[model samples]
Target: MMTPLGYSIMQALAGPVFPLDMANFFLWVTALYLGGIQAIALMVHSKWLKRTAETFLTLGTVFTFIFFYFYLNLRILSSHLYEAGELGYMGLIHALSMKNLVPAFIEFASPLQHIFFMFGALMFGLFQISDKIKQISLKTRLDSVYAVVAPPCPGEELRKAVGKGERRDVAILYADLWNFTPIAEKEGPTATMGLLNRYYALWDIVVRRNHGNIDQFVGDSVIAVFGLIGEKDACETAVACALDFLKEFPSLQADLADRRLPLVKHIGIGVHAGKVAIGELSAASGQPRVAVIGETVNTAARLDSLCREFKQELLISQTAYKPLSLEMQSHFQPMGEVLVRGKNQLQAVYGRK
Candidate 1:
């Protein structure tokens, strides 16, 4: 693409050996460098883009460098034809057929080519290093946030989570500590946060041990998911997880007492089976967070709220309850159909204390 400009450039440089055309080559180099710079400048702030921007810039730099090399070579080829009294399209064909072109490549690949190669490599390194740092930072943040035990996922599974409407039938588990507002108001922010963290840390162990993912953490509440992975029945896994949590309740309270903090207890849990889409999330300019979306998540949260009203420590939707093992079902009481928040129709839910 730069051939015509290179041809004009070659003409002026022939007399002075190093002249106006050399200066023009520098300008061409600047243009290629700036193209990469502008693209990175625009996309560097996004997490998704930051992950890919270096690759994109690297490709652009490589292609540009390739085109420039061919353009300069063709420019030199054009000059040979002019000297031989061959001109225009036919002249180009004749010049290309000639065997004398090999020596010209080494002649042109001097200080300018070396400089361009170094600068382009330098720019690529900068983009790649920046991208890697962001990746490490985001992974660290996710480690703290997701802090749940889940089966190892192939690289593609996480990629799927970033896509829109990537839905599947997964079990949702929503749990929240009882009377969080009162506790926070009584103990102040620091103590409340400490308590919340401790509670979640314990629950994190339960969910991870049960093969579930903590889809998200809302203030005083955690929304976990089962069947996003593993071959186990979603409902079965969810019930087992909840049962484990409830059975561990007394032990958790005892541990708190040992720490000499307020002896507190009780968290409500609601389980529902349905579809969930791992909603793709955007990064804040400084902070990045992922979001979970779909009606199933909402239904699970609503079920958790109703647990307090039903005076039960665990409440599960009819859909989830149906899939429970016969032995497990025997322990649950039928709470009947009740209106759930954000739904136009009443939903049948069961309870266990």
Candidate 2:
């Protein structure tokens, strides 16, 4: 196809020259035009055009055969008319050879080709637009979900909490969903997340409303701290939160049934109190955070992990209980001394009635 255009361009560039024979002229023209179309296809990144080009090129070979048959008929009829000089008969033959037949073939084939190209272009454009919309919508939903589920960075909040005293003593609580890893293996990843989310939804409301900061969520466990807001009954608040979490878990489990999920949820909560460095850990975007250190944090983990052995859901240490007002201590029932792992001395433990 490019032959026609290339030869014309070459002729123009080199000045006028004698034209080639019919065969050479048509061959070059066909080659130049085909090449130009392919170049255009490459320039545009449209799936429709690419597919159409493949189809058109494949079917283009048939058009050549069609043209050959028509050309032969025209030659034969032209010879007959030239031998007889019957102008009217020649006119009729001319219409069959070139006027009606050739134009009709061109008209029919041109529309089909255009339709193929157009359909391809439209399909490609639609697919691209659809993909972009899906991606944008997914990103937007994820951002919104994160805003609700994840706690805000508390860089400023920690400073304010720290400024309350030379050493800010806060009660840290850790709660782990019992058998979460084993449950995930049994139920699959989708059901496990759904179960975890339902459980978080219940605790999020309880902890936030009780003047507690949801410190962090490690997999299926929740770490919350109290006394950040004020020096209120820190132990009492921590105990209440633990008891409330225990109470609320059952209803949350029932809700999972509606989603075709099993309801096997148990959490072990360990509460301890000590001084901690509080601030944002991430440098990228200024997000506020708090870091709890010392034996208070360690004891909390120790007590929480021991829940399985003791067959209890909530455990409060002596430090966490020491700050409790008389009324708060009255609500807690004493469980005898128990030895914790990595500790030589036995640690006292308490349970809520």
Candidate 3:
């Protein structure tokens, strides 16, 4: 944006301007600026686009002299000394015939200045492209972490809040695939892992479809979060995803059997909704990981563990239950208050047998 006008002003100061040269200069300047802006637009899209821009610009810069070399050769071939009969009449005729093969070059007042300008442009493009690519890479990595573990948010918004803790109200789902250890020990390690792979694949589809984040997977357990992490609230979708997993459990088992994975159909889920502080937490290695930390998150996982004692497949705490839509409220049955092992008070747990 700053180049053409500056050059034009300097040129005007250095010499008398002719009407024809001024017109040509203006046209070329316009074309240069327009093309530059458009290229920048394409380069901003992704790392792929940025690399493509850098490659094209660098190649053009690197080969700038090669283009001039070809032009010089073409001019020599077209205007040979053969025309003066130094070689022969035939050579002169051949050199004259080669005139059509000569390519025109864009004339510059000073070749050194032209090269300097091109070098400067190349560096400008590279610096811009490199900086943009870094931003994109960092954003994509952060987004993947949030989508997988923490709540989903816009990349720009997330960047503005990085490392800074902020409270969010969300619904957390903790699901454990039960009886897998028995199957693994009975059927051997290979079949057990195969089952887990297929089982997790099944659950991933449902969770993503429900816009729920699969926060962490430990061994055979899956932790999912619903609520503001997605379009719907935790109370609305968290319980639904749990129920869907149970509803689809038998069918998945049958599919696993067909694949010779093993017969195992045990999944326990706990749903709770409350406030959590979301941010990046660094480990001893100084490696940072995005985390959702709060009592609500712990309570949800605890409820999932409670399923082992109650012999129930799905459970929801009052935090998630009370906010349930009327139609949803009808789907769950009250299990009364239960003394959770780590809790100070009896938790009012609800279950769907």
Prediction 3 global C-alpha lDDT: 0.66
| Model 1 poorest ten-residue lDDT run | 146-155
Compared to the true structure, candidate 2 yields what TM-score?
0.53
Give the poorly placed runs of model 1, Cα more than 4 Å off: 1-164, 230-232, 285-290, 341-345
For model 2, how does the per-residue alpha-carbon lDDT over 1-353 read when each residue is reduced to its tens digit?
45566655775575354334233344564575566666765575455565565445434434444554444555466567766775464464444432355464455446566457545655665565565444334433332333236553454555665553344677888888778888889999888877777666667777876768777777887788888756667777888888787876665555566457757756788987776655434446655356555566677888898788777888888768887888878877778687754568876888766
Off by over 4 Å in 2: 1-148, 155-159, 163-167, 339-345
TM per model?
A: 0.52, 0.53, 0.51
Identify the candidate with maximal TM-score.
2
lDDT of 3 by residue, 38-116 (tens): 5874658565665565555544444443444544554464466655556674443343232322323344323777667
lDDT of 1: 0.68
Per-residue alpha-carbon lDDT of model 1 for 121-224, expressed as tens digits?
66776676675655545543433454333322223564465455466788889998888788778878776666666567767888878987776666778887
lDDT values for all models: 0.68, 0.65, 0.66
Clashes of each: 1, 18, 1
